[model samples]
Target: MQAFIKEPSKHSHAPDPDRLHIIRLKNEIKLRGTSSAEAPSTILFDVLRSTPLTAAFGLPTNDALLQTISRERPAIQLDHHVRLPLILRQTDRGESFILYEVDSMVIFTCDKNLSGLVFVPVGDVLKAYSSLVNDFDDEDYLLLDYFERV
Candidate 1:
């Protein structure tokens, strides 16, 4: 009788550790590339950096802000479940500003890159936008700019 030889399996059922490592590295690289291109980190970093609004506008700590939000939840006008970031443009001068609302306080950055942070109570959001524009306006800027959430 001839001896029969068993053939080797074409594929392994178990995952290869090296292959898994390669996949992880590829995912990390893709994430890093996109993050740098969109530069969303600036906003995220600023959000953390400006915690408690950094008291830049005499605002209370994050805990205190949350308390205030709960207290004034009824009056606050938020269309969405969460207040998204906003980009406001000056009507007259054509300057742009970015806004992020944390609880009842709104954080403002004069430039999109978020070079500086300024904040105001949610109630004064519109006025805050106008104030920034007026700061650079050659003439008195009577017109107000509206918030366009991004």
Candidate 2:
């Protein structure tokens, strides 16, 4: 998937440190476009940018995602467990489903089967587990769709 990165302005003005920093951040994100071999931190950034749903959460290989969330909302502690409503969608297929329940080991998708149950392992969700233990808000959950984009 193509990353929706904004082009930097081509102007020479009084160098504002903050503006330069912002430009650098944008450039860094562009460099880390959706690729096959992605770092855990890049995965987290792409995930958040891909979707508007803010109901996704998981334990990434590193604490980058967690640190960002915590920094954004300090009321939440590091180990707080808050059940997240898993939302899944295939961007290429244009299909969407809501997984109502997420456990320590798996997430139960909206898919129904012979046993009236369909589930995806927690590990498969970008190699992270959704233990319903993450204290993330609806806005914070938008990062979950990064898997489909890549």
Instruction: Specify the highest-TM-score model's number.
Output: 2
Count backbone overlaps in model 2: 5
Candidate 1: tens digits of C-alpha lDDT, residues 24-54 = 4334434543444333334333343534332
Itemize residue pairs with steric clashes in candidate 1.
none
Query: How does model 2 fare in lDDT?
Result: 0.41
Question: Of the candidates shown, which would achieve the greatest lDDT relative to the real structure?
Answer: 1
Model 1 C-alpha RMSD to native: 20.1
Residue 50 displacement in candidate 2 (angstroms):
20
Model 1: residue 124 alpha-carbon error in angstroms:
35
lDDT of 2 at 92: 24
lDDT of 2 by residue, 49-131 (tens): 64333323322333654354334432323233444322233222343343443445444333321112235566565333343
Candidate 1 residue spans exceeding 4 A from truth: 1-77, 82-96, 112-135, 140-150
